[model samples]
Target: MAIVLGLRVLGIDFDDEERIERIESAFPAVSFVRLNGWTIAELHLECFPEKAFHEATDLIHQLGAYGELEFVEVVPHLVNTSDIAKLTGVTRQAVNKWVTHPDLGFPAETDFVGGGHARQKIWSLYTVNEWLSEVMGIDLGLELPPMNLVKQVDGYLALEGDPLLDGAKDFHASGL
Candidate 1:
């Protein structure tokens, strides 16, 4: 069991190959790649039998603590605007307006899909929670479920591995 961490560092220049090389050297075991035009580096580290999931997760947290990472939140799952509205005890329309309002400090949706007539937006739950507590001065009082529940569901509902990891592996294997 392994956990994949996605880090967003704001200061780095993603287009500079030399800077990327330096980052790769700093983390030889982990895979790092630019995230489009976001100026963020996505790191993927998969451990074998040597490191347990919890240990790996801890190390990843430590890296964030020691590095220049601007945002380091564990992305558990994606939630829609309606879900956020329900959690915050507000209407979906209110949530939509909040997303567009820059003063609310709401995290931007991770994705936007559909054609001109139809559009959908989605956000990472972790980010939403962080913004709620840190920016909005609101806490939904979220707490982890019982260990029994976690063990039962275990891998059944975990987020899929980061695609950058898969693409990195392929690129390395092909000597690209």
Candidate 2:
């Protein structure tokens, strides 16, 4: 399984690429991906839970020394627009409209193609949930702590995709 820890480092300028580079340099093994202002470090696990735990602890300590690393969310996997539409019981076009329409307060896409090309938007579950609740006023019945509390405790919140989401990926594979 692949585990990703999204770290939102506090009190640092988001434009400080050098500082981020330094942290990445310190941990050569961890694969860090830059998102908005968050640093997502991915770890692929095969065996030995204890070893992985130790590695994570060591990395957290190193990161803590540099700045306050607030836990963003454990990325379950990436999901596209269709998957979201299916999950929310909405049409794909509606989802697209929601994303593109101004004043909708939709979360920014993780990736998207622009200018003549078809847009391939993607987002994490956490981002979607937060947007749904805060902006759309749709409660998903998920019992999650407030963002402030999660950040205060540096708690890692897992953003998991449901079976419907997994099946949607398969549908894409089968050219459905």
Candidate 3:
């Protein structure tokens, strides 16, 4: 089975038409979206879990050849009440009620955006899915990608550019 991973790439110029074409040509399978100005590219890829780290590293390295590779991370999906409602085909009021009812054991918001009246609560998609399955007894009829594997891949990738960890050997053997 293939797992989908989201990658956040920073310090790359998306305005250069030639560079964009080259990147798209080289990474045909990756879906890239420019977000928060021209410097960040959000890339989505579907690949075997075992190959995620290597594939992400190679892609980042290739992108680095074009510009500075400041940071790269495997980001998880975040959603709000409206997103939950849309995803589960329910009303936003229902989601809000679930959140407000303490007996429902709904997961707390992972983040908050804006302030006061405009504030919106955010939850990890995985967290919400688990709540739906275990608490609400609802199955969305789809398996979420293995988040543990994704997190491990993210951790391994984080060690890639750390100078202090240079020449590190056999992370698994070391029981890291």
For this target, which candidate reaches the highest TM-score against the unseen true structure? 3
lDDT of 1 by residue, 82-110 (tens): 88988999899988887889778778789
Off by over 4 Å in 1: 1-76, 144-176
Residue pairs whose backbone atoms clash in candidate 1: none
Using lDDT as the measure, the top candidate is: 3
Give candidate 1's error at residue 12 in angstroms: 41
Candidate 2 local lDDT, 1-176, one digit each (tens)? 33334444444455677865676677655556666545565443332443444444456556656545544454444567888787788899998888888988788777754446775778766788878778887777654333332232233222112434544543332323
Off by over 4 Å in 2: 1-76, 112-119, 143-176
Superposed Cα RMSD, model 3 = 3.3
TM-score-based ranking, best first? 3, 1, 2
lDDT of 1: 0.55
How does each model score on lDDT?
A: 0.55, 0.55, 0.69
Assess the local accuracy of residue 4 in candidate 3 as a C-alpha lDDT between 0 and 100. Answer: 54
| Preferred candidate (lDDT higher): 2 or 3 | 3
Reference-based TM-score, model 2 = 0.38
lDDT of 3 by residue, 22-125 (tens): 77777775545664343444444467766655665566666667555555666657899998999889999999999999899999889998899999989998
Error of 3 at 66 (Å): 5.6
